[model samples]
Target: MTLAIENGSGKATQWQKVMVVAEPTRESAAALHYVLSRVVFDNDILYLLHVENPTFWKTCFKKQSSSTSREGGGCYGGCIGGDVDFLDQMKSACEVVHPRLKVKVSRVETDAKEKAYVIISETKVHGIDLLVVGKRQSLANAILGQSINGTIRETAEYLVENSKCTCVAVQRKGQTGGYLLHTKTHRNFWLLA
Candidate 1:
């Protein structure tokens, strides 16, 4: 799917508001950082968003309630700390590299489908000029039942199919660890990771 992008009036094009779909993984973190480093302008506002399954909290609650650990000790694996930490790291990197950029973080609890809708809606509401998403696995591999990214890959596909803003899906090349495929942004570009 493609959106009708209005070209700048013979002036240099700059993204003002950029939103990156983030997950608690290396690929997503890399994608966020890559976009911040390559596309964001000094005055741009960057939003780092993560859509989490609400059931994750329920499971964590159950684990904490039935825990064998001491009071105030809970399941760190199920906590949102990892996600928040990842965002913080990205924000710090952005500040260091693009000192004038503003960074914002948001965590939304919802299912995959609702997550996609929320992303699209938020982009429109925030007037985002660029939307970046990271795909954990190849689309072909995911369709072949080798899914690793799971809901994240689906959310990325949904954004590619439905978002009205310029959307880029960053996919990591296997093993090589330095090649990235930027899908669905007028032209497909490969970058060294």
Candidate 2:
């Protein structure tokens, strides 16, 4: 979904456009929604993607196979209702806040490693001017080391580091919100000060 907000300051400047990557996680989705509401931008597009990593599922099933033999039925890591429902909830929340924003959702059939590539590829393909993502709390990220941030940092780090588009990482505060904005238009890629 694309939402255009005129800068309340009557300066008459071109509104900047941004593309937000939506993951089917409650915390991540809520964080993005909070950031979007707080940020004063002109146009915003929401790209919701549900990546089904067959490899990850295979690995998970492999781990459970031996256990299942001893126990009754093995745990099949396929039908994830939580992830599916989270996306729907996020879509509804976005619509309630920014009815005009254009929202697009797609199912990605790729592993975690390839998911980053797909996201970056789609970003370029869609001519996205900016990329916005939710940042997990440091503690949560450390506990779940192989998180989306780590994947992006490892796989698409170069793309994110060298791309000409702007990238913003938003995190939730006690009740408010905080954001880290980085502009990669100049010297390679560096964090915004």
lDDT for each of the candidates?
A: 0.72, 0.55
TM-score for each predicted model, relative to the true structure: 0.70, 0.59
State the lDDT of candidate 1 residue by residue for 1-193, as single tens digits. Answer: 1223345776554547889987767678667767865788766788998888878777776777686764557656425422257667777888998898888988888884588899898898888888898865655654755234554446676687688988887875664555465556443466765
lDDT of 2 at 20: 59
Worst 10 residues of 2 by lDDT: 184-193
| Predicted structure with the largest TM-score when compared to the true one | 1
Predicted model with the maximum lDDT: 1
Off by over 4 Å in 1: 1-15, 61-84, 138-153, 174-177, 185-188
What's model 1's TM-score? 0.70
